[model samples]
Target: MVDWIIFLPACFALNMACGPSNLLAMTHGAKCGVPFAQKAAIARLIVFVPMIAASALGLGLLLTASPFVFGIAKAIGAAYLIWLGIALWRSAKTLKSEEFLDKSVSMKIAFRTEALLAISNPKAILTFAAFFPQFVILDAYWQSYAMLGAAFLIMEAIAIFAYALGGSVASTFAADKIPVFQRISGAMMCVFGTLLLMAS
Candidate 1:
């Protein structure tokens, strides 16, 4: 029941801030030069699914609860979104130096980094809980919830993939222009943060 298209951008933005994905991409950009696609896919696989499941469960519980609890959850979720937006905005301006980029980072390191990032991201958890049930009709069968869940998973998968690919391609062309890339990526993060605040 949720507008899958509308939810895609929010999901993408939330995932973009994911520490592992961003760190891996930044590390690769700085050192071994792995394609963004590879990094993104790994990030998505390791991080997204578990978060999505956790979110679905949390959201489902909230939706099934009383109106008061639901309202409290919404408020908490909104405030968290605002905080996340600010944090991301600040991160936009801080670029890792080439020296930092030159360090060797293993896939295992990348996976652990992403896992921690995903686990600690309260915004991601609340967003999934708050936004997912909007499409579910209470009177409808349980199948409605299942459908929405599947739709969200698919949308998030595609959006994260595209973002990673784009980042990889853009990073390649901007390889000679690291400063520019950093600035642009930073600005984009700020913009995403702003959007999240506005949406909340």
Candidate 2:
């Protein structure tokens, strides 16, 4: 049996952690719209389903033991983040308040970006492997694992909504400073990418 009493709060904390993925949600929300951002966020959740399953199947342990694989994964993720940041930074120059939500970034691009980011983060697999086992019942392993995965996805959705809403609100609050918001978001993403690269 899963321990809901202990699991729920921990799940919520991980879901709401200030991370690059959540930042991407906020950035998308601010740049496009809440609805668009929410839709884009779905891509990550879709990818995470397989990730959680892989963790349950012990791929997470493989990643933990394989520093080469982990390094490669982080490098790819970091490069993409840096490129995305640079693109956003450049786009900010031409972003108009009236057409902010109608800018160059397409739905397809957003979905791909979200999916790639989720897939390339090996740490996510480690997180699931390390965290989920505590609540999982060995007698009902698959069932409990599936339940925890479901709970995680639910919390992730909630966190996505919250971050996207925050970005939308911030966009509204700084309606006149859209360019500034873009620049800040871009810079933050770059910093995140750099930090990811630096992480050992």
Candidate 3:
């Protein structure tokens, strides 16, 4: 069995390999700038707390037991992703300048956006259900799970911040191409949403 020291870094690397959420984070980071974008990422993680807890507490099994229930959740998540992608596509040309930063993206908006992307991810929930057991020793399950969750959060946070830094840099240099960046990001999100649906 792999120790946490070995497992967590592997998990972190997997997270950083680029996925829908990571793409969204990178795009949002460019849109909102760094530390603020990192907050949005963390906020999204906060929103997932309930699901994480549920997975650890056996609700994951319960939910999985009912195909109908899981299907509904999966559908809702797919819909939300598609909807969010459309919204991003529609707002591809949102004006951004120095003064605009003041009214740029309210924390509320950022939190909601990130939360939607985070929470609606069925893959995340399923991954938790499947993967957590590998690291868990039921003899000391609760404690082990707690440690695992902490590692997930820590690694995820670090990855988000790193992606945000990359975004901030791109935004700084190609500030004039904000609209182009938004369009590309929006298109990618839409593709991701479609991919999710197809995965079902």
Best by TM-score: 2
State the displacement of the C-alpha of residue 119, model 3, in Å, after optimal TM-score superposition: 1.5
Which of the two, 2 or 3, has more TM-score? 2
Model 2 bad stretches (over 4 Å) = 103-105
Q: Which stretches of candidate 1 lie over 4 Å from their true place?
A: 1-36, 39-46, 59-104, 139-142, 179-200
lDDT of 3 by residue, 166-200 (tens): 87788888887766776777777777777877774
Per residue, candidate 2 scores C-alpha lDDT tens digits across 100-161 of: 85545699989988998888766577679889988999999999999999999999999999
lDDT of 3: 0.76
- Report the C-alpha lDDT of model 1 over 110-164, residue by residue, as the tens digit: 5554554444444555655676667566776356556665655565555555555
TM-score of model 1 relative to the true fold? 0.52
How high is the lDDT of residue 9 in model 2?
A: 98
Model 1 whole-model lDDT (C-alpha atoms): 0.51
Clashing pairs in 1: 30-101
Worst 10 residues of 1 by lDDT: 23-32
| Regions more than 4 Å wrong, model 3 | 93-103
TM-scores for candidates 1 onward, in order? 0.52, 0.93, 0.89
* Model 3 residue 161 CA deviation in Å: 0.2
Pick the winner on lDDT between candidates 1 and 3: 3
Which residue pairs in model 3 clash with each other? none
